[model samples]
Target chain A: MKLTESLSFRNIKGRPVRTAVLIALTAIMAMSAICGSLAVMSLRNGLGALEARLGADIMTVPASAVSKQDFENIVLQGSKGYFYMDRSYYDKIAEREGIEKISYQLYLASASAGCCSVPLQIIGYDPDTDFTVSPWIRKSAGGELKELDVVVGNDLSVFVGETITFYGVTCNVKAKLDKTGNDLDTAVYTDIGTIKRLIAASLELGMNDFKDIDPDKVVSCVLIKVADGYSVDEVLNDLNLHVRRTKSFKTTDMISGVSESLAGVSGIIGILMAAVWVLVLVILFLAVYMSVNERKKEFAVLRVAGASRSRLAGIVMSETLIITITGAVIGIFLGLLMILPFNGLIEESTGLPFLLPDTLHIIICAFVALAASVIAGMLSSLGSAKRISRIDTGVILRGDN
Target chain B: MTITATGVCKDFIRQGKNTNKLTAVSPTDITIEAGKLYVLMGRSGSGKTTLLNMLAGLLTPSSGKVLCDGEDIYALDDEKLSRFRCEHIGVIPQGQTAVHSLNVLENICLSYMLYGSLKEREAAYPAARELMRKLGIAGLENEMPSALSGGELRRVAIARAMLRKPDVLFADEPTCDLDDENTALVLQTLKETAQSSTAVFVVTHERDAVGYADICLNMSGGSIGKQ
Candidate 1:
């Protein structure tokens, strides 16, 4: 070791209690910064994925089959539920003047059956007409979903080529979607033919929600994209006015509520981070100040032994750097352990989308957290270093107060 | 190098109701020449320590200039003056002054480590070991300050001060904590250091230190006079 490093290590080792406390304080600072930033970033990434996934400009659902809130809960909160409307609504919506393109999906809530560990929200889309879920599915599954082939959400424990029976109908898992950090992560997706088979199987078991409804002629909801030059509100009004026994609304309206909730959550996280930083900064400053005061005589001896004022300051800063860096690495590692392994728990608890950023983004966050901790260490120690460096060597050595 | 203090004095403000100023050392002139051992003897509370501090560049006098080899040390900024002290002055402060964290060998070589390059500091180990051997603490190099007795620590300080072969060396109460045998050993080392062409200044209440001095001085009421 260099002389300064050896000296700093000895000084740190000489006072075990003080050094531990300072290190603990820095650790807490770094931990909070990393955890808080990762949480906020994950929520943002999840929300962005959700917005992109909800590709339709407007949607129509059966008025008596599902409440608007319940439909939103199924889509946004990943709640396990299903509803059906007559397939004729899809034709009516397609005939509307402002409707540019239209598609409909069927939803089936599955019971805990073969290879399934829990109840799941099963979404069946028409591969021929889909504009939203198809693009995402192809990105992962690499091809069109075939008969009896299932593309599972990221959160499912099932893997590719694994066969899972829903309502006694067997299907092979084609691919697993990437995480959306929402209820979608827990959902299963399949093509229209497989969904009809599952529905027929459920009907034979007397487990279907609407026993009288025809499985082949029913859809859960109709998704529509407004043509250019037509406002979404105008088409939405036209659909509600002309369509019967159905509710029509803009998709943005649903997302706006989610956006508000996200804003509130982000605000609270920001406030918490600010509070932690301010409190830690003050405590760190005082800790450094008191440590210098306690070691005043030692510094005076260094002065008497020909250490310059700046040299004394350098010694103190070096010690601070060592402590802060050690604390930062430990804290960041702990944060990664907590967040990466239990992201589902966090998403459920916060009721917010919690997709972790890509590897590059995570590395950036770590660097930012490390920088914050080191800067805090340096800033807190600066005053103490200056004070000790400028101490009256003669008086201190003479044991004067 | 010779150090000369001209019209130097120190006054500290008494921190009480009146904010009255107390003069610690009166305005006086003194010159320290190389190759001599000068002992400043006085009672407790005499200004001997303050005068020694001014001459060693550790303390700035409230008035007048302290010149070393024709350059005013007090006129130089803290950086230059501290470097000057590191290069030419070595002070063994009064009382226990070890940097408790470092072991004996590290403490002894602290002067060289302060401003020397890594290679230069490494090269100083041999000289430091020689000083430790002469001071009778050769085998205690790895011991901490807390593990040593009062006199051993004093020898360590002496070894540290002499490590640089400084042009001027100041020993404050160098034998205050020693028995007769150790006291004789320390005073003889200072006297021998002086004979080798390094100026040595010592402040003490021990009369035994007087015999080792080439020139003895006395301080009373913040003023100095030849004894």
Candidate 2:
């Protein structure tokens, strides 16, 4: 038998309640660890995928009119906003020799009565010329997007065909687009003309502040794509000189910001996981220490009967290992449960653009938890074990006392 | 089979207000030999068990050496000394030290295994069964010590100690809780074990057990004089 099996069979078998408690404690710690790990890994992967797909390069906004402290924040802070694109800057970019084709797209967060309890985002574009749809968009309708006709993304399609009142006018879901497993999946693609009409109508209905949008003029942000020949710096400089109050940013910067935020979240998660381990170990140490103290005389008897201190220590350590291993296995299963439900949440929050964690991450995490638990058990038992194993039998067995 | 204890002193400092050092046991010199049944008789505070423990290698002397077969047991490192004790010495405590979780057969088997004679089962088990049968508690092999009567527990404890076939066997209060008839039976059991290559050391103040020993050494006032 392994040291663990023997120790458990001999020692733990005697105390049913204690053994159960130790296992439960270890399992709970492991579960917390797994939950923390899942959160970190998912958030990181999601943000990374977002950055990669969006080509997170540098961006330029209308240089802050505010002081240097808030200078960067002036244009950047309003994370999701729409401003008019200056036609004059577009003319300058075309006139520059090295500069290549320039395209622009508008954005909107659209919602309608749907199966989901939350509002969804809708993006409108001129499929033929929009820079954001320059290459990847494959129009499943066999022709370019038209006025009032919306090509529903995979996510939107579920609630798309059914009438969703947008600005009090019902629209049709012309066709369902392919899944991108990204923010695109949550978006509804239609002609820019339809969006402009919606903005005009909502304003007519007297809705002004966003949830109540003046649909007549509502365009949240404009996505501008620079051609391969012209560097982003050149375009940014030109736009800064020509357009006032209109922010010109490469798509890259926005995506990078999302990725950085995820990194910060992952760091916090890791710290929480570590704290759980330490807490669990402290609990284990107390339990084992008290139990060993109760059996002091028993250890004395064994020592007198010719058990070397090392052998006795081994027995004590083995008892802990056995308890920790049992608890860790249960904890891993619990940990997995903790991480599982959040898989869909991660996918939704990050737009499902990143790779889902496979069995490998789960298995590796479980093994690590088990190993840490066993080490914790050993550390917790150290003090009591020394006292018992090195018992001074001479004093205990003397009849004079 | 010679065991020697020389110039032994032991002091116990009880924890309390105005703490005092109480000298419990002080012995000059003593020797034990093969085939001898020695009895140590003492009053409640006479230090009889302390002397017995010193001889059994369970306790180290405050300032002296206990040599068994020319080697000071205390001088030996833990493993070597423990091995010597496991193989060469056997002790029967006052109450049942027979592990309660194990049945009779397992307890007897454990004694043989612990003393490093696991393969010598034919010599250990049959002897255990014959001893049990002679003690009149023959068929209680599977019964736990908690379930057994005082006499039965004592008999089983003796059976385990004797099964190891050690060079020396020490018993403390072997017949304290037994009637005359049972005492005689236990004494006979001791005599049979002593017939083999072993020395019998009994520590008790009981008159009946002391009367039957080959050597009776009376103890009083923290010293063993003569019988």
Candidate 3:
């Protein structure tokens, strides 16, 4: 008899109710794994798009602090002459060999009322070369730079067509940008000259906000974009070394540093999922082991019928492959069905986009599950098949009868 | 051809205590001609079943060699010995146990398919159909083993054992659980199959089976024929 034929017949022999229960468990394991994996993929994709859109590719802030600290500190600490960047140096570095382009925007705000009047970041950029603000600016302005006009980001768009006073100067929102689902969505965009005028005017009038403003301040910090072939780390190292020579110029004080939390989140999820996979492995092991235990008589009969050890093991493995593979395929299908309906909702909430599993993931998952099932079945059958092989058939006949 | 065994001893450490070393048919030589019906009668735990197992190549004797056509079966390795039994010897264990998954027809068909020559198998269906008809189980061929009664199952088991036209047949209690009618029918089938030059060895406590035997070996004292 063919090894597969026997195994197939055996796998299907149990009562319908019993078989269904076992298959359902396998399906759950498969579906749960796929769901977890897809969640990871969706989140990572969202975070990636967000990161690329954010101006923080590498923030230049005081080296001691990371994250929002640089933006906030540069605003708070005025006379300390610390956290300061000469905004004019941005244009000079834009001409550097390895640098692509630089963007510098000063956050300008004025106290209005309550929480609704939170200090807004005012982004300033050169019209021709800025890719950083181009997305939001294009959306809000309806066109490229028209001198003196300003664009607002998504969060600020609710106040569209409304004018807000800051430092006693009123700037009307010319247009509102589509939501990028990031902090930039809350900021305002204008040209470099417009922000410089606001800061200078505020300082000259000695407005409460302008009393602490640095008159000689050029740009808070330059946004450095390295050319395609040049390394950012190498450029930063060179720039820092050159900038450190001046007593008042603090290269370390200006650079914010790299953020690794996104990568860290992915790693943590991976470890947690691995632990879950180990538990699934244990379940798989038990299922295979139990099937072997139940089929002791069958294995013994086949062995006495002269089946070799390898062929007997083949029988067990064939059954496992059928079960595991069938379960996994059904699982992916069920998982897709489960996640797809809520896909848009998740994307909306998490700021992440999701993609359907492709043919490659299906093929690879099938191959992996099959291999795992076969190996697990082979291992589980070891003791039972051995016992069958060594059974004294004459005694079994006597005892059994 | 006939099977012969001399000075066979088999030991067993039964139940972790009893050192039951069975010297079944020990130093006793017997042979029956081809195409004969033979019976061994014994009580429970007697060595008659063990002796039949050795003849069927299911067990190895401690000392003696079982020769069929002058070839010692025990000398062959496990696979070769199993192949020999599959081709040349048939066995019916105690109780009319059936391979329950396969229906009556498939059960008989599989037995012949395992041992029949390729050409013989090409014509197997007709032969099996004829056997079923003769045994009055032709209509039950599609029924699973569990659906059959004790008597019906015994007839089916006998049909399966005789499927390959083996040279030697070993049956343990072929009619043990059958009524008078089924038992007689079973003996009649054995007698008919023996016409093809197959020597049938039957182990039973019942005398009805002994009446069909050309020779009787009564096993006692872990030996055969009372010395």
Candidate 4:
């Protein structure tokens, strides 16, 4: 072993209680940093996903689906369900003075029994009028989607060119969307013709629940883009007054509660991380101080044995660094163990989108956390190192008798 | 080399209310030459250790200069003085000076390692084992200081000091807590060390220490006199 390393190892090994306390405190600091950063990143990604996937200023749904509870479940919690509004609402909204664009969509759910990997929501849109899903489909799928071609969400198990069956009708997967960490992740997008054919197939198989409903006359929702000179409230007021049995909602307002909840959670985690840092720093300082105080005579002996003051200080600093590095490794390992494997469960329980950042992002965070731990160790040990450097060797050695 | 102390004294500031200053050691002149065992005899607080510390370059005298080979030792800065002591001076402190974590061999090689004279443990092990065997601790190289007797720890301290074969050896009460057999052994070792052309200064109240001295001095009430 190198001289400094051997000396530091011997010193740490000699004092078990001091070493253990320092390691434990540093571990707590690192663990808090990792977990807190993970949660904050997850929330940030979730909010970004919401912004990207919603892609519309306003949505008009059936009046029965206007409850705040249902709105939160569908928008924030990614729940799988379907509702409908009359197709006439889309025509009226599109002709309004302030409307820039309008598109209609139909929603349905697939059975869990051998349909796909899981029970999922399916959305069908008109390619000619769609302003949202069509742009992404064109960008990712390289062209317009045909009658039987479907784009799957990031969470689906199927790949491109694979087939997924819905009520005895199978469709080809053309492209896969990027992860949005929201309900869109579990959705499949196809043209309205496929949905109509699936509906007809269901009706033929004795699943006649849709026999009274005409696919051409009904839509689940209408997405609107207000004109440049008009505000969303102006269009919303006009739509609510002119349209019957339809409710308009701003996409931002629909998920404002979730945004507030995320802010609260992030604030708490920030405070918790700060508190852990303060506590760890205090404990580290105290532990090092006490250990140094107790070893005054030993330091004096080293001085008389021809050890320079800087060398003594280096020993103390080296011991602290070793403990900090050990703690950081263990703490980060535990953090990764708790987070990576159980991310889905955490998302379900928290009712928030939980996405692990990519490998490079995780690596950067771990490096930053480890660096912070090293800085903490250095800061906490500074006083002790200075004291060791300035100790009066003659007095200590002579007085020890 | 010869260590010369010219009217050196030490004064410490007392902490109590009058803020009085206490003179721990009165000014005294002494010369410690190589190839001699010099014993300074004093009771518990007679300034023997203070004078020894001054001579060993561990402390600065308040009044006079401690010169080694005609160069004032106190003129060197802390760093240079530390290097000088590492290469030229060795001190066995009053009691229990072993670093408790290191075993016997590591303890013996510690001084050489601290001074960077030996870069690797392998380079230090042969010398350390030779010293340990000379001190009658041949088979105890792997034993911890905590498991050793008082005499054994003292021998380890002595081995550490002598590892670099310094010119001057200053031992403050080297046999303070030892039985008759260990005391004799320790004194005989110091006697043998002094005869090997090193200046050995031993501060002790033990009468037996005087028998091993080539020159003896008595200390009383912060003053020294020839014995």
What lDDT does candidate 2 reach at residue A290? Answer: 91
TM-score of each: 0.91, 0.73, 0.66, 0.93
For candidate 2, give the lDDT of residue A162: 58
In model 4, what are the clashing residue pairs, if there are any?
A: none
The deviation in Å at residue B49 for candidate 3 is 2.2
Which candidate, 3 or 4, would have the higher lDDT against the true structure? 4
Tens digits of per-residue lDDT, candidate 3, A1-401, equal 44333534544553344455545656665666666666666555444444445543334443332344334334211111223445445545555567766665455553443322345666666665566767756755677756546776655644756775545556777788654334445566788677667676566565556555553465555566667887766776666555542111223222222124334545675677566556656766676567665655545444433344455565566555566566666766787777757765654454332333455864565455445434443454455445445656677666556
Worst 10 residues of 2 chain A by lDDT: A71-80
Per model, state how many residue pairs clash.
Answer: 1, 9, 7, 0
Candidate 4 lDDT (Cα, whole model)? Answer: 0.84
Residues A148-173 of candidate 2 have per-residue lDDT tens digits of 76666565545535555566656666
Using TM-score as the measure, the top candidate is 4
Clashing pairs in 2: A56-A252, A57-A252, A81-A220, A82-A220, A82-A221, A199-A215, A199-A216, A200-A215, A200-A216
Instruction: Kindly report which residue pairs in candidate 3 clash with one another.
Output: A60-A254, A61-A254, A61-A255, A61-A256, A87-A218, A87-A219, B7-B27
Every candidate's TM-score, chain A alone:
0.92, 0.67, 0.50, 0.91
Q: How well is each residue in A1-401 modelled by candidate 4, as lDDT tens digits?
A: 56444777888888787778788888889888888898789878887777776778888988888764555566444567777777787788888878888898887776676533467878889988898789888877999988878998888889999988887788899999888666677888899998898788767776765776688999988989888999999988888888878888887887676788788888998999999999889889998999899888888888898888898898889889899998888788788788878877777777777667888998898888888988888889999999999987888887776
- DockQ of model 2 vs. true complex: 0.24
Candidate 4 interface RMSD (Å)? 1.9
